[model samples]
Target chain A: MKIKPECATCIIRQIVDISIEVTDDEIEQFRLVKGCMPVINEEYHNNAVPAWMGTVIHRHFKKISNCEDPYKRLKETANDTAQNYIEDVENKIKNSDNELDRLKKCVLATIAGNSIDFGPFSISEDIVPMIEHTLNSELKIDCSKELLEDLKSAKKVLYICDNAGEIVFDILLIKMIKKYVNDINDIVVAVKGKPILNDATMEDAENLKINEFAKVITTGSDIIGIILEECSEEFLKEFEQADLIIAKGMGNFESLTEYNLNHKKLYYILKAKCDPVAEFIGVDLKDSVLLSNKQLQKNLANIDKN
Target chain B: MKIKPECATCIIRQIVDISIEVTDDEIEQFRLVKGCMPVINEEYHNNAVPAWMGTVIHRHFKKISNCEDPYKRLKETANDTAQNYIEDVENKIKNSDNELDRLKKCVLATIAGNSIDFGPFSISEDIVPMIEHTLNSELKIDCSKELLEDLKSAKKVLYICDNAGEIVFDILLIKMIKKYVNDINDIVVAVKGKPILNDATMEDAENLKINEFAKVITTGSDIIGIILEECSEEFLKEFEQADLIIAKGMGNFESLTEYNLNHKKLYYILKAKCDPVAEFIGVDLKDSVLLSNKQLQKNLANIDKN
Candidate 1:
């Protein structure tokens, strides 16, 4: 989707926040933030993608501050916090009444785990208590049933991940799908090539042991989401071959449609973190959605007809 | 005060808000907002005064939108809202036992009346119940007693007005002051030369019959706050001559300090609407402050020493 004027303020806020996170010296903070103003001047407009603009400015922030990952500490904490719940999640899945129930629980956890994101919190937001919270709160757009049906006949599944801590749950989710849906033979997981706002890097995927379940590849750039031009030939090949694509986080939800992979069933699983995104998605702000790209098209068509 | 990095986002939000307020046509709204991005590009910096930058952007918005007053309806509604409460405020002041109490009530009413501002709300927020609410809410940094003392010795008072609706209560504030302070001979009310935001204009003052209470003058340009460079020599003379300058609203509170009028006993009376301004004033957000410019100098000096 094209950027709203609201995105201009929101991106600047993110830039200023990371500037503060990277430095304590008020003069340095001012310099760091002031220097990045030109990025917004260049990138904010009607035609720019919000995530694409967010990527450019955050990359600029990384350059000016001489910081590889401003969200390093937060990402580590998010990872540690999520990793702590692995055994409990495993136990919960095993205790479920049936494989269908287990699959639903796993899917729900992956979506809910997104809330333990750096975009919202400065530190680790414990996801242990959140398991119960997710169970009680229904997805605003529930497509888990349809997702399972799509998975039943699929030979390959591509899982694109979001944040550091959230990726661990996604790995566990992949395991459940592999076990339950026997037809899903091949699975490819995608993480960012480098750090961009606490997004999972190759190092995070390695640390989390994601390759034990599925072949993990990098998106080849530190962009905010899946901006196709910024991706590698290797990632593009997998994106083309995949039968079903499961995209996580608002960042991926924002950028995935740009690639036109709707012919291949693409399910967007996220907690809409912003107004414009949520409003576009036909949900309330912070609503958890497991929506297909086909559903996105249908929703847009309905809105147009209205 | 120099602009904070956060101010960039805030100014953009203001620009976008007025764009929406000015027109319903989506393409025109986008055009109006996009056309003004260069203003922020030119004006945003560490050393630039926020109100000055604010002035530049809003003026740019006015020019691009081709609408002289985007807030005309809102301003009229605000004035009407405050005008409805004049009799009740008058009766409350008269029924008070002593002149000192009546003076305090009038001062509180002027400060409280500013909440009927455009910056916070889209529509008119009634100020009737606000009178009692104002009486109950204590000032965060009150110099009202000192203000009354200063008014007693001064033969001249320049009440730099803020918004359209709030000026109605301020006119009544002047009437009460003229009655109680026998030494007060000349009372001059300063308003914007043109409509800026929802700030009071010459026409508003004329319509509200402000001339019956005090000589109404304009600051010569439609700037957000007092930009000394933007003011005419005629208004500058009055600014120089006034013994006690009672500046209302956050706009005047922000700009009056820029004029180096600390020696002139300038009293700032308004609710600190945003965090950065409140932080500078050593108060919490939304706290009503009746502070002195000398106090601002003291606060900065102490910070430098610390």
Candidate 2:
């Protein structure tokens, strides 16, 4: 999606959030924000995607603020908070009588986990309420029925995780998927190689004991979302080989939406955070979306035929 | 006061406001905001004053948007809304039994008018409720008694106006001042040389029929506030010669506060809208302040001595 006029303010707001997170020294915060203005002015373009712009702005922010990971403390807090909800989520799935019903509940839990972002606007310390809200609310775009069909036949599943605390919920979803799919060995969970915002890394996977369920690997870049050219060859090979891709969060949705994946089936599960992204996906702000790329392509093809 | 980290976001937000105001075309709005990123990045400094930064950003917004006066329609609306309150304000002064009480009421009315701003944050269409709110609220920094004392002895008063609709209230205050201090000829109302933001200019003065009371002159610059270096020699002469000065709004407060005015008695009457300005002046956000240069200088000198 193209960058909106609102993105400029959103980017600055993110810098402000980071600056405040890094230091209590108001002078230092001011200097950090001032440093970001030039980078935004030089790099911001109407046609540019937010993830691409975010990558550039965040790079400048880290260098100028002298804080390699401004969201480190916040990420830790999010993970700790999210860890508390793991038992409840696991119980929600286990209590379900039917396998398909359990899988659907797991999908909702995974989408709920995507809410724990440490970006500029999101300052919520507790994800329990947010998770509850997501669980209770109906999805704006539910492609879960089709997704379930895809999951039944999928040989390899690539589950791309979003945030730190949210990873625990992803694990719950993975466990459910293992029941229906070939095995845990066939599923590969992709995390960020390095720290960027609150995105989960290999350390988070290790901390959450994700290795017990499915093999965890890194995307080999600190970019907020998956940028194909920046990814490691090993991750790219896994991405190419996967029959079904479950991309989590708005960051991945923004980065991977425009790409021609050569008929690979991808399902985007996220809460539309900003207006631009919401508008791009034809959903309202704060709507939980479960969209299938194959279905979207078919709809577009039908429109072209008309 | 020095620009805070919060100001970076606020400045970009102002750009967004202008971009939306100038054109309905979302693409053009996006382009306009993208253009401002560099100017903000390159020019924003922690040590810089907000008014100085605002001046730069507004100038950039106008240039990029190709709209010379972005707030023209909003200014007209503000003036029209404020004009409706003139009768009520006049009644407020008339109903007061004593001259001093009437003058105090006029001061409140003028401060209330200052609320009619077309800046990034303010989008309220009605000033009646705002006027009522201001009238009922107490000033955070009540230097009104000192201001009245200074007006008693002053020969020439330089009244610097802020926004459009707010000018009507200034006229009311000027009328009250004229009744006590001197004739309208002795009082000169200073406005912006050209259109910038919703700042009152000679055109606004003419639109509101300000000539009925006092002589309105241009400050010889389109900057958000009174930048003395950018002003014409005529305005500087008037600024230097005035016995007492009444500066309205936060814009003037920001730009004029740091200057060494050689012990000139200047009264600032403004609502503390933003956090940094409010914090600098030792008032809570949204609190109305009536502060004098003499009191401010005394406090600073005491701090220096300590």
Candidate 3:
């Protein structure tokens, strides 16, 4: 998605959130914020997506403030909070009568995990209410039925995880997919090779014991989302091999939606947290979205024809 | 009144609103928006208020876009719309039994005019509903009684106007003050020397026929709000001599609040439109405030003591 005027504001807001977390020095915080404006003006053009812009701006923030992984403590806290709800969520999925119902519940659970993000604003101390709220609410863009059909036929399913605490929830969905849709051997979970925001890394996947359920690998880059050009050749081979890809969070949706990789099917499961993403997905801000590549292509085709 | 992190976001949003109005070229709009970030970063620091920062950033926007007075058409529309309702508003005040009651109603009418601003967002097609809503609503910070008391004793009153459409409402209040509290000869109306945002200029004041009601003058600068240092020698003289100064809009509130001008009384009458301004005034966003310098000093003194 091209950077809209609102995106510039959002990028600065995110920087402020991180700046506050990194330091209590008012002067230093002020300087850090002041420094970001030039980078935003220069780097945030040429139809840059938020994730790509976030990557560049955040790196600059870290360099100036000398605070690597500013979201470190928050990530741990989010993981712990999300860990508490894992059992309850698993039971909710288990309680559903049929396999299709279970699969749909898992998709909702995964999308609920996307809400545990700390990059945009301060991390919520309690995600229990958000988890419950999302579970009860209907997905604004639900392509779960289509996703289930694709999952059944796909040989390999690549699950891209978003935030740290949310990775615990992703485990539940992965387990459900293995039990109902695909073999465990065919499922692989991809995490960031390094930290960018609170996006899960191999370290988080290891901490969550993701390897116990399915194979885990890194995208081989610390970039916020899957910037295909920046990814390692090994990760690309895996990406190209996968029959179905489940992208989690707004970052992935932004980076992936820019190009048409017609060789593979992509299903995005995330909460539309910002205006541009919400407008793009035809949903309200904060609405959970389960969108399919097929549906997106059809929408694009319609727009082109008009 | 000091700049907060939220103010940066708001400034960018305002730029976006103006950029969209200036051009249809996405690339040009993109370039214009990108250019604004550095100005915002550089100007909006070290406890700078929005008005001060806005003055600097908006000047750059105009320089780049080559569109001076971008809000010209919207300002005309706001004036026409507000003019249509002047009769109904005057009637509402006339229905009041006493002078004090009529004065209070006029104060409300003037605040209702402040809502016609088009700088931050698109101009509302109709302001009748907003005026009606504001009329029926209670002021979140009403110092009208105190203002009335000050006006009764004061020999000279300097009334600063905010926007074009709202100036008509200011006329009603100015007329009321002339009839009940002070002579029309003692009253002076101050507007911008040149166009800045949708803020009222000498042209607008003349268009509204403000001379028929009282003496009218310009502040001798095109800056938003009453920057005391930037005022012309004549305006400074009037500003100094006035027994009581009635500053209109959030711009005045911001610029005036920075100094402790103890010699003369100042009453700010405006709607709190943004988060930082609302927080500064201790009112909710969109709430109307009629704050007196006397009350503000008292509040400040109490805070100091605490």
Candidate 4:
């Protein structure tokens, strides 16, 4: 599951090469961007693909020494890089800062809106189905009565969220939780604050309207983990006190696994979106479905009745 | 320079797309690899490109989702995606344990065995001169006799290095210095340890043979920086005591600039590989090559005479 260094460079080269196809001029622009480098050698790809793709063209052009007709190669690379970049941008916009949100908006508008209208781009037009599937697969939960009971008795809940493109789903889930729960004050939604390339920063969480629903907090770390390396002591204290933590997406799963909270309640809700994570959880990576804390969901109903 | 989230994503996309183009089996292999995923966007371009091309074929795949060849479109997207995957691999390689030492062996083997291949990529033969020119221009230095005299008075020197691709050049430069200075014991080369995605880790430094001629130390951080974020305080204290500190690459430059060194000795050596760093140092981005402390080089001369 670990990445080889050669493969890492190869991926970067491919990203860079593709960007050149779109426009080599952007290569320099991309090289200057921080956090554009991808995460490597882990069980899951997580943030690796998108972070490297966004500004990869320039490096490719430079690598090829700026060929006279780099379009074919550039175009080829762009498709690969753009797919990952879009995922990452969406994640950042949903979970981190305004700048990223704005940039994501601009980029989406360009690719899905303007660029598609004028040039050759193969992006899907209707994203709703994907959204639905992502939610169904990535955000499904066990809605049994026992689960509801556990929810009622839970002292605190932590919601760890994912991609900007998918934030609407998260918001909807939060609203649903509010309707079911009596004390909304006990819920905490954690989001990104500062931008570190494509990773969700604290600023991203604010824009997604996640802050409006609960106690929103930002941990300064670029990677999603529960270690408190980037999160302040206060945040860590809050995390420790929470009765339940619902982590969404692959990044959080990758970094937080080390914590393995035995004393506290926890739930991992996500689509087997990436391979390494799925492998870790012993699930099919391509299941195209959702999984929840089946036992917890059952328990919640019992607790709620009491 | 900090990367804008959208731009970063875009670059990643570009790389992912290109990777798919390299091979068809790689696609299935990629899926098998950790973190790989198929494009699940609802707007799958089925009609844009031809199917025979598998993932790499293009004409069938238009840039538009509505294009005629869905297969080609998918292939192009795969190509872009491949790039992203490659980066993931490279990051792992760079962050591998004892990367510097490993790299040293690789480079040495390549140079000695005349197997200087960057994988299957032969590159445009012209890229070599361009890269050479870039390194030469960016790393240029003009040391004065007076500056050499000043440095010769110092007791030690510390070299903080950058990427694996460029470490060979650094080694060459180090050898040049040893020829002139008799106090080889004073030289210390610091590299990164463990893996941190895109940054040059301590493993990379060791692989590159930085430990052979100088005292090698690994900063635990994934990226290169001067403040020693991951290194122990004892290491920091030693770094502070060095008569000269030669920092290589843009990462170190960015992290080191904010420090208040007072009258302490420092030497920043790097190629203005990107624009912002060039602007920061008042150089042109297109001008390739690396630079070093002009005065510090001259200062070493007086030590030889003494």
Output the number of the TM-score-best candidate: 3
Q: Per-residue alpha-carbon lDDT of model 3 for B86-142, expressed as tens digits?
A: 888888988998866777788889988988887544443455677788887788887
Best of the two (1, 4) by DockQ: 1
Give one digit per residue, the lDDT tens place, for model 3 in A1-306.
766765776787777777778888767777888888788777878578889998898888878888778888888988887888888888898899887788888888887887788765444345567788998788888888898888778888889888888898888889867764455657889999877888998889998888887888889988888899988776787788888899999899888988777666899999887778887777788899888988888877787788
- Candidate 1 CAPRI grade: acceptable
Across A1-306, the per-residue lDDT of candidate 4 in tens digits comes to: 232212433344343334433454543434422212322223124333332222233233434444323233322333333344444434534653443333223222222211211011122233434433332232123222333455567777777654443333455445545554456667877765433212334444555556677777765443333435557665787688777666665445445555435555565554544344454455574333223455534444565676
Which segments of candidate 4 are over 4 A away from where they belong? Answer: A1-128, A134-147, A180-182, A197-205, A286-306, B1-306
Model with the higher DockQ, candidate 1 or 2: 2
Task: Score candidate 4 by DockQ.
Answer: 0.03
Candidates ranked by lDDT, best first? 2, 3, 1, 4
Candidate 1, residue B111: Cα displacement in angstroms equals 4.0
Scored on chain A only, each candidate's TM-score is 0.92, 0.94, 0.94, 0.55
Clashing pairs in 3: none
Cα lDDT tens digits for candidate 2, B62-123: 88777888999988988888888878878878888776677678878888888888663545
Model 3 ranges off by over 4 Å: A73-98, A116-140, A181-185, A202-208, A232-234, A279-287, B76-105, B116-142, B181-183, B278-287
| Residue pairs with backbone atoms closer than 3 Å in model 1 (clashes) | none
- Residue A278 error for model 3, in Å? 3.8
The DockQ-based CAPRI class assigned to model 2 is medium
- Candidate with top DockQ is 2
TM-score of each: 0.87, 0.86, 0.88, 0.34
lDDT of 4 at A246: 67
Q: Model 2, range A1-306, lDDT digits (tens) per residue?
A: 567877887888888888888999988887888777777776677778888888888988888877777788888988887778878878877888786677678888887887788663546345567778987687888888888898889899999999888887888888766665677767999999888878899988999888888878999998878899999998999898899999999888888876986488899888887778887777888788888987667655776687
* lDDT of candidates 1 onward, in order: 0.78, 0.82, 0.82, 0.42
Residue lDDT tens for model 1, B65-103:
888998898788888888777787777777767766776
